[model samples]
Target: MAQALAAAGARVLVVEPNAPHRLPGLLGAAAPPPEGQGQVAPGIWGLFLDPEIAMAAYLRSQVRVRAIAERMVRSKIYQRFVAAAPGLKELIVLGKVMMVYRGRHQVAGVGGFDQVILDAPATGHGVQLLRVPRLTLDTFGESPLTREARRVQEMLQAESTFVDVVTLAEEMPVNEALELEKTTRDLLDFQVGSLIVNGLCPPIGEAAAAWDPGELRADPRIAGAHYAATWCDARRRMQQQHLRRARAATRAPLECLPFVFSADEREVVAHLAAQLRATGASRREAC
Candidate 1:
């Protein structure tokens, strides 16, 4: 997202523990666009912020984030952020992205430009990450960390920050998404941001016939794995349905990203960027 947003003319600073991968393909599949390429292209710079450990790591890293910001702040491409993006809705996801790395338990470093879009890890660890603020508040009651947790918790509670929980469109993913969303609402009082129902098979306009010619029809291939290709359309439709139901069950509205067949490096990055850019949720809510 940092690379993609930078491509769209934003000063994007990505804070990693060590050196950046230098390309999206390493993380998934996108290639970074040219630097200082004008509003036609945004500037993306990376900073190392790992050594931070535990809730204490959340301590304002302004001294560190400031240095990187100073370098890119001069770029004309970055000036776009200074203006009022009347179209930009304030994004509502305050992520306590307690991501574990190098076998470390708590998030070693915490940072994002104006908005920290944490592509959080899987369901198992995601819970701990989101709960850091609350947990830290409980453990270290009135200390600086507690104060930090309070600030974090306030952001989480405010409309500005949502404890976002994402999942694939499958059953297990759906179950996890629902659990996380409700848990966030109940425990943290952070309204779940839009439920991101990822991995959805997009609507196949002409391929709708795979369902049936009339009201209802059964395909024998559906029951047999040997004819998997024959029933793929049916499975795709089922996937879509599952995604919808899961989103409907959550406090956050559902936002779906089409299932892309292109996993190629450059293609993956471009596609994800396109998907993010195209999401009405981002545009509608105002960030």
Candidate 2:
């Protein structure tokens, strides 16, 4: 989503809280070549500031980083991405991204930009991070951290952004997706913007088209029409079941990322932008 937002002409500030390369390739090659690369794409600025400070400045500095990162990414365009990605602007994101900044849910940083897409971690950890701002606000009573926290919270609650959550599209992911939503409502008390079901599906509809209905209950002109139909039906039903659950489970809109059985991640981000455009999300947000 960082790539997607950046492509749409937003100054992106990627906050990274995880240990550098603790889990390499998580960000993938979704990065532009080193400065030597061709004219890099627009609307992205990643700064991987480590939360543990293994790579970041420090405990105090990390707080500053969150506000700065948020301020950098708030684009007013109110649109979804629609362009070729430039990969990473630099090797670093803003800060320890893998960690969520608690009580800092309302991001006032990355100010002036229209949107702020956090590559935040899961609910268990992420929720805890988001609550920090609120906690500090209650305890600190109008300190600088509290000010930043409220801003971050507002952004997260912004109609345009809901501490939007991103997780793999699987049983655990889906369950986490819900838990994230509920936790936000009950604990942080914010509504998440959308649930992105990433890399989902085995292409039931297309596979069904491959089989011949008439060939079924016959001498089998094909490999096995009956079996194919059953498989396709089951798969389609499963896909629908997920969709139904998404609709039924939470109030947040569910977005599907077509099963990329074998498509480049770069292509996936591009396609995602296109799909969002077609759905008028970009335009609607603009309004």
Candidate 3:
């Protein structure tokens, strides 16, 4: 999706907070050869936000001293204290995202990305991350931390910020997607912009139903083809069922990403991006 948006002439930055290795592994040969943050494609760039690195950058911005920021972030006591504090880590992560969202970071003289995409934590932790600012404000009154948190909260709640929910076309994941949508609205008052149902098998049931598989049983090759088609048709039907349930569960727009048969993650992302673009629902401003 990032690639598609970037291809459409939007400056895009993908921030991976969950697993740094995941995005790099996906971009594969398309990823820039150099170390640290680099462009994944012409208009799309990737960033891996290590907690310590994010802390150092943030502290440097606050203190205006790189050496002091480095010392503070490297301190064992500071690390332990940050880990011990509830929502502190989540707050910091969100704060870093807000920085990028608002073009407040200067790394090697490159800053102000037009669009910042955060591959944030899973549903539960993501909810917690969004709630941290309000929680801190309520608990700590007024302080530098809470002040920063408030800024992040405002950005998150802004109309320009959108929460996209992605899930598999299955029972459990669909249910979870519904729950996540509700939680985002109820807890953070953020409406889910869309529900992306990934890995949908092609619907071949109509063609399968018109064919007679028994006639091909005598030929192994034909029989194998028939069997594969039958299996795919069944899976597609199942997915359609789940997709219907998902649509009924939410009022938000829903999109299905067809299953791609490729070992390359870059190909998969490209396929999904194409699907996203075709939907004619790509919100350039909110992305």
Instruction: Report the candidate with higher TM-score, 1 versus 3.
Output: 3
lDDT of 1 at 104: 25
Error of 1 at 242 (Å): 0.7
lDDT tens digits by residue: candidate 3, 51-131: 656666667778877788778888888888777767776677788778777778643346767777878677787777778
Query: Each candidate's lDDT (Cα)?
Result: 0.49, 0.50, 0.75
> In lDDT terms, which candidate is top?
3
TM-score of each: 0.59, 0.59, 0.88
Collision pairs in model 3: none
lDDT of 1 by residue, 188-215 (tens): 5667777776666644532544434342
- Tens-digit lDDT string for candidate 2 (217-284): 56664546557766656666666666667657866666666555445655666676666645454322
Q: What C-alpha lDDT does candidate 1 achieve relative to the native structure?
A: 0.49
Each candidate's clash count: 10, 55, 0
Better of 2 and 3 by TM-score: 3
* Residue 241 error, candidate 1, Å: 2.6
